[model samples]
Target chain A: METNMLPFMRRLQGATCTWLVQIAIRENAENLPCYAPMNIIPVKMPITTPPPDTLRCIPEFVLENVVVLITIARRTVKLNMDDADVVNLLAPALTLVLTFMGDSSRTYNPHLRARLAECLEAMLPNNEDDSSSHNNISSFYREQIFKTHPHRFQLVPCLLDVFVGIEMTGQSVQFEQKFNYRRPMYVVMDFLWGFEEHREAFTSLAREAEANMEAVHPPIFLRFVNLLMNDAIFLLDEALGNMAQIRNLQNAQESAAWTNLSAQEREQNLTNLSHTGMLARFDNILGRDTIRTLVRLTAHAPFVFCHPTLVERIASMLNYFLLHLVGPNKKNFKVKDMKEYEFDPASTVLDICRMYVELGKNERFCAAVSDDGRSYSPKLFTLAESVLVRIRGGDLISSLRDVAARVSTIAEQRQRDEEILANAPEEFLDPIMSTLMLDPVILPSSRTTVDRTTIARHLLSDQSDPFNRSPLSMDQVKSNTELKEKIDAWIAEQRGKIAHTSTSSTS
Target chain B: MAAMSPSERRLQKELMSLMKEPPPGVTVDGDQASQNLTLWTVHMEGVPGTLYEGEKFVLQFKFTNKYPFDSPEVTFIGNNIPVHPHVYSNGHICLSILTDDWSPALSVQSVCLSIVSMLKTTAGQFVLC
Candidate 1:
C-alpha cells in the first residue's frame, strides 16, 4: 500500500493550495479531526506503525518548506489570503508537531523544532483585519487536540514544557537544549498579545489542565502552586502601609492613588503584619488572577467549586508554610533547596489562615486537620488557629480579632437602628439614618461603615477605595477617634432607652 | 563620628522605638544610650522551661551606612552566644534574615523579636560551643 509521498511534498514546497486540499482530505482520514476548527480530535492518533521512513523526515521537510514559504510570503504583497488558507497550508506540518508532542518515545530536539516556531511566528498575521488567525489556531487546538488528550488540557503547560523546561522531570528524556525554554510561550504569547480570543483558549486550557492535575494529586499540585506563590506573597506582605508598592506593578489606579510615602512614613505592609497576610493578599495583581485560576480549577471539599482537593491543596500549603515559619529549610522542595525560598513562616501561617477563614467551613480541611496521615500536621487547623491568637506571631490575631469585634458591633447597631425606626418620629428617623454610625476604631474610613478587615481584604485584591472611589491605600486609613466616641455613646444611649422602655411596659 | 545618613536616622528611630516597646524577654542594654547610633547592645532572657530558658544572652547589633538597606550584623557576645546548632561558638548567628533575608521593612524591633522567637524554638541539643 505504498502511495507517492514525494509529489505532495513537492507541492508543499511550491506553496500550492492543491497540496493543502490533498493533505486536508487524505491526512484528515488518519489525522481526522486534526485539521482546522472544524473536526474535533477524539484521542491521540495511535502510533500505527511510524509514518513510514519517508514521513519520518517530515520536520526537515517542513523546515525546507518554511524557508521557501518565508521567501514567498515576504514577496507576495497582494496575496490576500485569510487565516483559513494559512492554517490549511500548514495543517499537515502541524500534525507532525502534535504527533511529536503525543509520543514521548520518539526522538525530539526542542531546538530543531524552534525553526518550526520561527515559521509560525513569521506567519502571524500582521494586519488588523486578518487578526483572527491566532484565534483560529487556538480554536483548532481546542476542538481537536482537546479530544486527543483530555488530561493534557492547555497548550500553556505543554508550551511551558517546551519553552521553559519546567515539566521535564521524566525518565528517558534527553535534551539538546537543556538550558532555557521560556522563549516559545513568550514568542507565541507575544504574537497573540492584545487579543483576548487567543488568550481565552490558553485560559480555559490552563483551567482544564490545573483541574485534572489537582484531581489526580491535590497535595502535590498545591505544594507546587504554594511554592510558586512565594514571590507574590512576599510582594504583598511588603505592601502593608503603602498600597503604592503593588499598585505600581499592575499599573492600576490614578496617580493620586499613590500616596508619596516618605521614608519617615514607612508604614508596615502585609508582611509587616503576618506572613499569612502576604499570602492572602495575593488576591491582588496578576498573581491574584493566577491563583484564582488555580483555585477555580481544584475541586474544593464537599461542594461545587468546593472540592476537597482544594481543601487538601490549602492544607498541604499550610503545612509547608508552618515548617518554614521561623527558619531556613535544610533542602530544596523540588529541584531547588528550601534554602532558596525566602519567606516568613508565621506570617505565611496567617496568610493561610486568612485563606481558610475566607473559605469558611471547608469540611475537608477540617477533616484533614484531625487526620495524622495528612502531610505536615493532622492538627493543622488547630495549630494555625492557635498561631492566630498569638500576639508575638504578628497581626493575625489582632487583625482577625478586630474583624470579629467589628462584625458583632455592626450586628448590635443594626438591631438598635431597627428599634429607632420602629418607635421614633419619621423626621428624626431620617436624620438618624442620614448620619453614618459606625465605630471608626475598627473601621477607619468615614465614607462608609465597612469594617477594616473587609477593606484590608479588598485592598489585597485591588487598590481602589470602595467608599470614595479613590485609589485605596492602607496607610491613609487612620482611626477616627471622634467618630468612634460618638458611635459608642449612641449605642449606649439606645441600649439604655430600650432598658427603660421595657421596664415601663412591664410596670 | 560621621554625620548621620538616612539609614542612620532610620536606625536611630528604630532603636528609640524598640527601647520604648521591646519584645517580651528582650531588654536594651542601658550603656547603648550613650553610644553612637551605629551600634546597639540588647539583652534577651531565655523563655522558661524551653532549652534556652533561664539563660541570659547579650546581642550586639552593628549597622553600616547601608543599615536598613543591608541587614545589621547581629550576634551574641559577652558571655552567652546560644548553644544551638544554628548559632556558632564565635557569637555569629546562622539565621538567613540577618544576612540573606534582610529587608528594609524589618526594624531592629522586629529583628530582636525574630531572634527571641528563634531561641524559644531551639529544640535540638547540638550546641556548637
Candidate 2:
C-alpha cells in the first residue's frame, strides 16, 4: 500500500507543479504580451543562456519550487527517509535539480538566472539553522531564482515567512554557526531571502515585544522588541494600501447610529412627559435618594461631571426640585447656606434655634414689648411670651414666633398712634406728646396719658429743668412750652449725630 | 567640555529662530557658554486667571544626542511646584508630547507654549496625569 501511495503522490506533485508553472507563465505573458504562445509551450529551455523577454515565462517560479522541494527532501532525509525515495519523488527530484542550477555561479539567461536564485534561496537554511547545506542552497537560490524573478509577487512573501519563523524561534546563533563554513555568496543569500520572506513576521514579533516591554527589567530586550515592531509596521504599511474603504464604512455606520438614536430619544422623552405628567412624574421618578446617588456617583466619576451636558442636566434637575420645595420667595434659602443635616428636617430645627439666638442679641425686642404694653392685648402678649419661652428652650419655632410678634407689634402701634393723633387737638397733644416722646424712659403710651404723672414729672424735671418753677396755671403753661422746646432741641441734636454717622459710614 | 560641533552650531541657530518672542506672561532664557547648545534653561511667568498666577517657574531642557531626530528631556527647576495631578511633586510633567506623542516636528518653543496653554485651559481643581 505504501509503494502504491508513492506513485500517486508523485502524480499529484507533478500535477501541482504543472498548474503552478502554467499560472506563472500566464501571469508573466500578461505583462509581456508578445510571449503568449511561448508561455503555452511547456518545453524546458537551456540553463546556460538567459531567456529572452519575448518568452514571457517566470523562470523564478520554477527555480523556487525546485529549491523548496530540495529543502523539504533534506528535512525528510534528516528524519531518516531513504535516498531512493527522494529520487523517486517527482517534487523532491525537481526541487534538487532547481537548487543545483540556482547554486551555480555561471551567468545565464537573465530570467533563468533570477529564477535559479529563488530556488537556491528556498533551499537555504534560515537564521534558525545556518547548516552547511542550507547556506549552499540559499546562495544558489539567490543567484539563480531571485536574480531572474526579482519582480515575482508570490516569491517575496514565501521567502519572508521562512525568515520570520527562524527569527521568532531564536535560532540566530545556530544559523550563524552553520553559515560560517558556507561560501560568502550563500551567507548573503540566506540573509536576503530570510529578510524578504519573513519581513511581516519579523515586524509582528517586534510589535509583540514592544507591547510587552519592561523598560527597567529588560532594557536591551525592550529596545529589540521596539525595533521589531517598527520594522513590521513599516512593511505592513507598504504591503497594505491605504485602508480608506474600511474607515469610510466605519464612519458611515457611526453616523447612522448616532442620528437614529438621537432622534428616537428626543421623541421618546416627549412622549414620556406627555403620558406621565412631566413635573409630578419626574419628581416621583427621581426621588431624594436617586438625586443623592447621582451626586455621589458624579463625585466618584469626576470625568462624567466634567461633561457640560451632564452638568447642565444635574443642575437643572436640582433647581427644579428646589424651586418646588421652597417657593419663589424662599429661593434665597438655597443660596444662603448649606449644612450637613439641612437636607433632613430634624437638622433644620437646629438651624432655626441658632437663628433665634442671633435675633435675641438685637435690642429690637424692647420696642416690641413696649408696643405690646400699650395695646394691653392679652393674646399678643401671650404669643410674645410663648415665643420668648420657646426660644429659651432652644426651639426653632420660638424664633419664628418671636419674629412674627415683633413685626406685628410695631405695625399695630404705629396705626394706633396715627388714629389717636387724628382725633386729638394738635396743640394739646402735639406739644406734650412730642416732649414725652423725646424722653427715652417714657413709652409712647405713657407719653399720651397723664396718669403716670409722677414718673413723667421726674423724667421731665431731672434734665436741667428747662421749665422754670412757677406758682399756678399760667406757670404750668409756660413750663410745658419751655420743656417742649428743650426736648425738641435734644431730639434734633440726636438726629443730627445719627445722620452724620450713617452718611460717613456709607461713603 | 568639548567644543560645539558644526552640527551643534547649526542646531543652535535653528533653535533660536524657533523660540517665540516672549508674550505677556511667558519668558525664555538659555545658557550661552555651555558646549551643548541643545541644553537650555527656561523661565516662565505664570499666566493670570490660573491657580499658578503670580508664580514664577524654571525649567530645564536636555536634548538627546540626536536632536530633532529625538525628543528633549524636560523637567521643572526650583521649588515652585506645579500642583497638577499630571505633574509629579518632583516636577516631572507627564504630558503626551513629552513621551509617546512626541514628534520631530515639535520644538522647544512650541512645547513651552503648549504647557502654558494647558495650564490656562484646565478648569478643574485637580489635573489628570
Candidate 3:
C-alpha cells in the first residue's frame, strides 16, 4: 500500500510547494527566517528606499520571504539535480517567483527592483566550491525559464536591461547602491560563457520557428546579433564623436579665429574638451565588456553572424571603421595610449578587424559577405594586409597575407578597367568575362583565351572545357604571354591618357 | 557607394552598353538592375518569326560578387516563362551555360542572346503541365 502511494506523494509535494510560493509573494506576507548564513547570498541590499508613504514600497516582509524562497529553491535544485521529481516540483515555483522578480525590474517600485536583483543574484549559481554543479543548476534554469516564456532567452536580455539601467545611472552619491546589480550581470555573463550546448540547441529551435512563421522582429538569436552589433557600433560612434570635438578644438586653437572668440566661449570650449576626456574613460570600460561579449559570441555562436542583414551591418561598420583608421586625415585619440582605457580605439579597431577575420574563417560567412554587389572583400583584404603589417608574425598571418596579396594584385589589375575600356582593342579582351584580362591563359582543348583567375574560379565547381566539353585541368592551360604583353602595354597607354587629361585640365 | 567591386564595375559597363544599344527584341530593366547589381530582371521577346514570336518573357539574373568568374544564376521568371523543353514551370532553366559549360567570357548580353536562341529553337518538344 505504501509503494502505491509514491505517485500521490509526489503530486502532494508539488501542491505544497506551489502554495508556499504563492504565500511568499502575497502583498502583506510575514517575514521568514534566513535558511543559511546571510553571507551566502550573492548580493546585498546596500541602500534602503525612502519612507513607504513617499513611494510604493514592496512590503519588507514579502521581500524577505521571497529571498528565503529563492535561496531554498536554488539549493534544492543544486543538490538533488539528478532527481527528476525534485527538479520538476521546484522548477514551477521557482520560475513563478523568478518571473515576478524579472517583471518587477520594469515596475513602479524602483528600489524593489534592486532588492529583487539581489534575490536574482542569490538564486544564480555562484558558490566557489563545486562550480561545475552550480553551472548545471543555472543551465537547467535557463531551459526551464525559456520553456515558460513565449520568446526564449528572455533571461539574458532581462539581465542586460538591468545592467544597462545601472550603467545609465552612472556615478552617483550612493555608489554601492548603483553598482549592486553588476554582480548579477557578471554571473549571467559567466552562464552564457559556458552556454555552448544550450546555444546550439536554442539556435536551431529558433531557426525552425522562424522558418515556420514570420515575425516583426527576427528570432531571439538574430535579435541578440543585432543588439551586440549595434552596441559595438554605438560605442565606437560615441568615442569618435568625442575625438571629432577634440579635433575641432585643436583646430580652433591653431587658427587665427581663436583670438576673435569671447573669453567665456574659449573657456567653455576648454571645459567641453575636459568633459569629453572623462566620457572617453567611461566608454573604455564599457567597450571592454562589449568586446568580451562580442569575442565570446563570435567564438561560440558564430552561426548568429550568418544572418544577411547582420552581416551587411557588420561589413559596413568595419568598412567605416577601417577607412576612418587608415584614411588620410586620421584622428588619433589620446585614449589609445592611456593605460586606463582597457578597450581604447586602437584595440577596438584591432578587435573589430580580428572579429571579421574570425568570422570570415567559415565558408558560409564568406559566401554571405561576398555575395552582394556592395561586396567588402577588397576593403577587407586591404584591412587584412594592414593588420598583417601591424601584427607582423604568426603562421596564420603569413597565410592570410598571401591571400590578401593575391586579391590586392587582382584589385590592381581591375582598377584600370574604366581607363582600358575606353581605348583597348576588342582582341585584347578575354574571350570570357569581356574585361581586359590580367593574366590571359589559353585553354588547351578549346583553343580560346580567358583570364587565369576566371578559369580557376570556374574549375572549382566544374572541370570540363566551357566551349568543347573536353576534360581540362589547370596544368593544361598555358599563359597567353603575347596577349598579356599587349594588354599590359595598352594599360600603360591608358595611364598616360589619364595623366595627360589631368595635366591639361589643371592647366 | 564606395568604390565599386570588380564585378560591379563590369556590370556597370555592361549596363551602360545594354542601355545604349540593346540587341533586337531584348531590353534590360535598367532601373531595377542599377538599384542592385547582383540581381537583374531583363525583358526579352521571341525574335519576329521564331516559334516564340510576339511573345513577351521576363528573365531574372542573380549575380554573385564573384560574377564573370562565377556565372549568374539565370532563369525565366514572372508569369511568362517561355515554354521550352529546357524551361521548367518553376522558372528553373536547364541550360549548360548556366551550370557546367559556364565561362567567365560570358556577359549579360551574351546570356540574353543565348536564351533568345534557345527559345527560337524550341518546337513543341515539352510543355509545362
Candidate 4:
C-alpha cells in the first residue's frame, strides 16, 4: 500500500517477466481459455482469490498499476501480432485490468480504461483465423468481467462519466489533450458494436436508468443522452461559427483591401480560409458520427430517447440545424461558397432526421414528441421536408417521406383546431399563455384557469399561482370539466366545417 | 403552427397584438424580432409629465424556451438607461416584477408599461435628491 512500492514494482516488473508468470498462474486457476491465431487450446487454471493484502492498495496506486499493465498489454499485442501465443499470454492480465474497472470504490481514468478496452478488442484472436475459438475466449472473458460486479456492467457507465461531466459543465475537453477527451466515447460505441451481448445489456440498463433519473445515484445513461444532444448543439454551433468566418473572409475579399494586397498575401489569405473550411468539414464528420451513435441508441430504446425533456431538446436541435440546412423558403439547402471549401451538413442532418423518422414510426414515441396528439413539431416537419426533397432517393428518403405524410394528416387536423380557436370565446383560452386550453385547470387561489401542461411546467420550478403570486401546488388545482365539454363540442363543430370545405373542394 | 411550443405561440400572439395596437409611448421593433422568437427589443419613449419626459430608452427581452413558466430576462439595453433608484448603471433593473413578482399573465406589453412607470415614479421621487 505504500506509495513508493509502486515505483519499486514498476522497476521489478520491467526487470523480469515475473508479472506475466503471475498472471499465467492466476489464469490457470480460473481455467480461462487462450487462443492462438490458427490453433486453439483451452487453458485450465483453478480459480483462486488473491491475498487480502494485495487487494488493499490505495486507489491512486491501483490507477498507476492499471496504466502500467495497459501499456504492456497494448505493446505486447502490437509487437506480437503474428505470435498468437505471446498475444494470448496477455489475456489474463487484460481481464484483470477489466476487473479493475468493476471496482466502483476507485475511479479509474476513463481515457486509460478506454485504451485498455480497445487493446482487449485488438487482442481478440483474429476473427477469420479461428471463429469458434474467438467466440469462446470473448464470451468467457465477458462473463468473468460481468461477474466482477453486482450490476454486471461497469466499464461503459464509468467511461460515460467523462461525457456526463461535459454535459454538466458545458465545456468539452479540447481535441488536443493526450489520448483526447472524446476517446472514451468513441471506444464505448466501438466496444458495443464489437459485442452484441454488450449492446443488449446496455439498452436494458439505459431504460432502467432513464426511469429513475432522480435516483440518489443518477444513471449515467440519462446523462449520456444529454451528452449526445449537447454534442449535436455544440457541433452545429461550431458549423455556424465557421460559416460566419467564411462570410467574413468573403466580405474581406470583396472589400477594397483585396486589390491592394500583394498576390502572395492574397494566396496566403485564401489558403487560410480553405483551411478553416477543412476544419468545418472535419466537424461535419464528427457530427455525423455522433448522430449515428444517437440514431443507433434511439433505435435500441425509443422510450429513453422520447423522454419528454429530451424529446423537446432534440426537437429544438433538429429545428435549428434544419433551418440552417434549408435556407428561408426551403430552397438553397446545398451551399457552395468556395472551391475546395464545400461544407455540407446534409449527412448529419439525414442522420438526425433519420432518428426522428425512426422515432415517429413508433406510436408511443410520436405521442411523446407531440403531447397534444396532433403531430410532432410542425416546424421540424416543414424543415425536414425542405431538405428531404433535395435528397434524391434512399431508405432515409422513404422513411422521411412517411413522416411527411403523417405530418400532412396532422396538419389538416391542426387546421381544424385553428379554425376552432379562431371562433373560440376569450374564456376558452388559457389566461396566462393565451393559447386555446387543453385540459384546463382552475387555480384555487387566483381563480384562473390555465392549460394543465403550462401549470405543471410552472409548478416544477415555482409552486405559486402565476396570477396571484399565492403559494399553490398542482394537487390543489381543480379540472374545469364544464369548459372541457364546451371546448370539445366547439372543436366538433369546427371539424364539420373543415369536412364540408374539403369535400366541396374535392368534388 | 402545430410545432410551435406554448411559449412560441404565446409570443407570436403577443407580437401580433403589440404590433396591431401598441400601447402609448411604446413600439416593438418587429422586423428585428422576426429572426428569432426567443429575443426581442422594444422602443420606449419617456411618458409625458415625468422627469424622464422626452427621454428615449430601449428594453431588450430574452425569453427561454420555457417562457411563460419562466420569466424573461428584461433589461434596459440602449445608451439611455434611465437614472433611477432601481436602475443599475449596467442596464439591469431592480423591479420586483422582473423577478419574484413576475406572473405568466404579464406580457411584453405589461413589462414595458411597468418599466415606463418605474422610470416616471422612481425618477420623480429621486429628482430633487
Provide the lDDT at B101 for model 2.
Answer: 62
Task: State the lDDT of candidate 4 residue by residue for A155-199, as single tens digits.
Answer: 455445545543332233344332234544564455455566667
The 0-to-1 C-alpha lDDT of every candidate, in the order given, reads: 0.46, 0.41, 0.59, 0.62
Kindly report which residue stretches of model 2 are placed more than 4 angstroms away from their true locations once superposed.
A1-11, A17-72, A75-507, B1-7, B14-29, B73-80, B85-106, B122-129
The TM-scores, one per candidate, come to 0.31, 0.30, 0.42, 0.66
Candidate 3 stretches with Cα past 4 Å from truth are: A1-98, A101-187, A194-217, A247-266, A334-337, A340-343, A362-364, A367-380, A387-396, A399-507, B1-129
Q: What lDDT score is found at residue A399 in candidate 2?
A: 57
Q: What TM-score does structure 1 among the candidates reach? A: 0.31
DockQ of each: 0.02, 0.01, 0.16, 0.35
Superposed on the true interface residues, model 1 gives a C-alpha RMSD in angstroms of 24.2
* Deviation from native of the Cα of residue A460 in model 1, angstroms: 30
The predicted structure with the larger TM-score, 2 or 4, is 4
How do the candidates rank by TM-score, highest first? 4, 3, 1, 2
Best by TM-score: 4
Docking class of 1: incorrect
lDDT tens readout by residue for model 1, A121-143: 44444435343334444345433
lDDT of 2 by residue, A216-247 (tens): 22222233322223332232222111122222
Q: What is the two-chain DockQ of model 2?
A: 0.01
